[model samples]
Target: MRFQEDSIDSAGFVLRKDEVLTVILGGGKGTRLLPLTEKRSKPAVSFGGKYRLIDIPISNSLNSGFEKIFVLTQFNSYSLNRHIHRTYSTNSIHQKSFVEIIAAEQTVSSVNWFEGTADAVRKVLPYIREQKPKYVLILSGDQLYNMDLSDFIQNHLADSETEISVASNSVPEDRIYGLGIVQTGENGFIQEFIEKPQDISQVENCRQQDGSFLANMGIYIFNTKTLVDVLEDLSMTDFGKEILPKAIREKKVKSYVYNGYWEDIGTIRAFYEANLMLTDDIPKFNLYLEKTPFYTRPRSLPPTKINHAIVNQALISEGTILNHCEVHKSVIGVRQFIDHGTKIYNSIVMGLDHYGYFDRRSGKIPNGIGPNCEIRNTIVDKDCAIGADVKLLNLKNYTEYEDEYIKIRDGIIVVPRHTTVPDGYSI
Candidate 1:
């Protein structure tokens, strides 16, 4: 709903003021999105053509009028840190209001890295306590969605006694093994919380009145004092296995049913499918929707252009130059340069790093000596170069590669960093 700070009047327990603080869990390795996450953390992976995945939550928080924001990072957070600071901000709200990075910094006790998700919070509990906010909103940075968090906050206000509010969604049984399952009582309070149920039958039993099962969204809203008290009481520090489940057993956790477009873009197949899905005119998650726009660092570049090309169902980023090529059902990241007669179908062309090896190998980008080169079902990571008349086709139907140049994950060929498959070679 894009709830701005100045737009709303006072609603004490309703949390209409700027007293709410947001802590984004952006530290995960994103091991699922391999090759792409080969260097940077998960949050920095480019998404929706123009924005990174972290932009979804940051933009969501900005739209919900929560100015006090802190993004927690772990390994390789420099890129993630730079991207967060550059994109989506909370301005005119002052020091605490702006979007900032919060890694596992030094402490009097120790400078140990964040042990777990909840432990990450425990280490920063002192700083968070200093702010003395009534509520601290926590979110995992990897999920893809556009939600009105104000609604979730209002739901929390309606049940102030609940110590924790977890965002839950309906999921199929095959997917429940990786998520926390919950059962609600007649009073709409949570009765039982299962951390990734062991048995398939037990997982199916956690159903709503309409026979739908509720699964955790990895998004939490915590009461400040309750959170502080809990951190002080426990040595364990993971939200799924420790905090929320423990809180649920104490009868202090409530489920906030989230009926929105939410997808866990953590795996290679999921990431690939998600990006390609955006090629649709009416994608499930449309960034152009003015009611709730996802924010990112505004790149002051010219619009995308396709010359002498046959492009289909692809999201082309700004400053991209395509000529005499075929880009079908894929995403091309910013500032991509395409030469004449290069066929890129059902593949992603990201940053320039992928082309660095080729740039270094050949004196020039090997002038296209011929045409009819078909590169399909692969990820040519940033800065990669393909020689003229090179062919990198999906061999699932033909035959897998005999050599180690291409990596096969879930049957998709991935050309690694600074790699060259040689010109006109077929697998």
Candidate 2:
């Protein structure tokens, strides 16, 4: 399972755009993210400062020169669909290169919605088979990481006998139970695959020599014929739970070890920590690399206006205006307006889309952080209206609590999209 460097030129192993078809699975309910996924799909949820979660994989594929991509969407996919349509267009690159979306639709062949990851791909096999891809690249939409897909494909091509190759990484011991565990032999071939083993000893047995266990990264490279054959014979709903384990028993599967930063933003605590990590002095994952930069829709927003505002160690997105505010260790999204005498600490203020639309049209309080509010350890989702003198401190340390305007998870207050906190309110 080792690639012979001399057999293949490392300098010229280029996976052509036409040779591969990338399928991005973006059809999750994202129940863990709750209010954020209430209106939009998980992949459509905003991430970092300005980009969506879907941008990571799409950008990685494009940067690796694989342009034929199909994003599979289901469950509250309006915003996700709109974002994809507005952002990605393949006509400029090549006539054959495109980023098309194949949503869950009712047809004569199948009337049910996608059940899981495997089912999602199974339902869209018709569109994928039509492309006639030599190797199919399957990716998850909610994970945040940068990878050169050509390298993964090149490794798979080097071992031409293997029908499947999976991308894996060494994960910390505490996170073993949350991910699928891969047991690889000495030759780098997958021997056993366990999906979320409850017993700690099962996870411990799979630990590598480096003290980290090999966790599945959810990135797979499959031979087109083998993929179709497996799908046709299996009635499994999920890949990790059923398809992968069965594939390991039958097909020749190999593991490509990735020693890089990868985060699966699947839960509220995970999302909160990942966002706050950007404010650190030296972040584990750097998003500002020029060689392989992250791509997103370019909003020609005005420069952030700061009028005597004291901010520290924060990621401030474009078009935000802060007046006489003290923001410490926070992230301010696009078009956010913080009025005078507001103090926000360890919080995320997702800005509004328009200015005074709610106040002018409906004569309600303006959409954004109003004057003299103090927010601490909170995540304010998009288009939120905070009336004057509102405080969201989470004093009770409620592990989980939900109300009309707020939902606290793991001590972080989450204000859902379009929610309004009336004047003089306190949480």
Candidate 3:
């Protein structure tokens, strides 16, 4: 449904603009997305050629008119913090609206770091309480979707009995193992919930009539009182693993089914596939939505200069210089300098952080994919220096391999951020 400027719900409830507080959970060590998360947090990890993973949820919240956001971050959050600070600025007149970052700190009550999702929010409860919100909208920092959160909130407000509302979507049986599955009765009242069940049969009873299972999208709306009560027990660390199931048994947790595009960028394969999918003729995650634009740190880079390049089905960002290159089915990020004779196919080149003027006479290799390089089925992270004649093709089809510079996970080569592959390097 389209988001309306008016805040009146169908149930005739006046949804206050300041009543819903947004809390985006920046993920933990991001172990599954390692190497990429080696230097930056999961949310800070770049995506869609120009935007970071964090931008998705933040943009959605802003578009939905819920601006009082607090991003809870812990592991490797410098880049994420910097990105948020630069991208989102609040109006001085509207002091109530802000996109603030709260990092994990050693408090007098607890000296340890955040254990899980619930723990992260629990530690920041004091700050959240200060917002004086009636309801709290929780989001994951590393997800991709354009949701009308105002509608999601309205659904929760529609039923006074709903203490918690979980945004869910149907997924095939094969995709249920890594997701939280929910069984719902009439009017989307959740009957049972299971988090990341190892055995498919564990959720056999939760399967829908169409053979798909209702999987939690990791988006939630909780009454302020309910959130505080559920998080009172410090032992309940994770929302999915510990808190959610317990709440499901006692509280009136409803499910709001989202039929739009949603993807959890949890692993290297998922990340690689999602970026490549953006190169599709009509991608599932549309970046061109006028009302719900994917917001990021706006750069004033010059338009991409394609010098006689044969490009097809690619999303090339601004300030990129493609010199006689053949880019097909790729997402080349901003400020990329692809030299002549390089061919990037089925890959994601997260371009340079900034343009560099290397003294060619100093025998220094610049920070970009040099000429005569062939990168296929790979992800070259930002600020990488790939020299000429380098071929990052997993020709041997190694499912898993790693070195100081590159890693092959699920048969896709990942050159970590700021890595430098010497001239004529091949893998």
Find the candidate with the highest TM-score and give its number: 3
Sorting all predicted structures by lDDT, with the top scorer first, yields: 3, 2, 1
- lDDT winner: 3
lDDT of 1 by residue, 1-427 (tens): 4455433323454344466789999856777677667788888877766788888898888778787788899877887888876664435544447787888777788678888888898888877877778889998888888888887877776764778888989876678787888887765577777888888777565866666678888888888888877777557778888777678777477788888778888677777778777888789877778877788888778777778888888878887777777778888877676666777777766644222222425445531212456777766665555555677776555333335566656556666655555566665
lDDT per residue, candidate 3, 1-427, as tens digits?
A: 4444448777787777788899999988999998899989999999999999999999898889888899999999999999998988642325577999999999999999999999999999999998899999999999989899988988888888999999998899999989999999988899899999999889999988899999999999999999999999988999999998999889999999999989999999999999998988899999998878888998889999999999999999999999898999999999999988999899999998888954345678888888899999999999998888999998899999999879998888999888989889999
Better of 2 and 3 by TM-score: 3
* Candidate 2 Cα misplacement greater than 4 A, ranges: 1-15, 357-363
Residue-level lDDT tens digits of model 2 in 284-326? 8788888788888778789999999999999889999888999
Candidate 1 matches the true fold with a TM-score of 0.90
Of the two candidates 2 and 3, the one with more favorable lDDT, higher being better, is 3
Q: Which window of 10 residues has the lowest lDDT sum in candidate 2?
A: 1-10
- Candidate 3's displacement at residue 427, Å, is 1.6
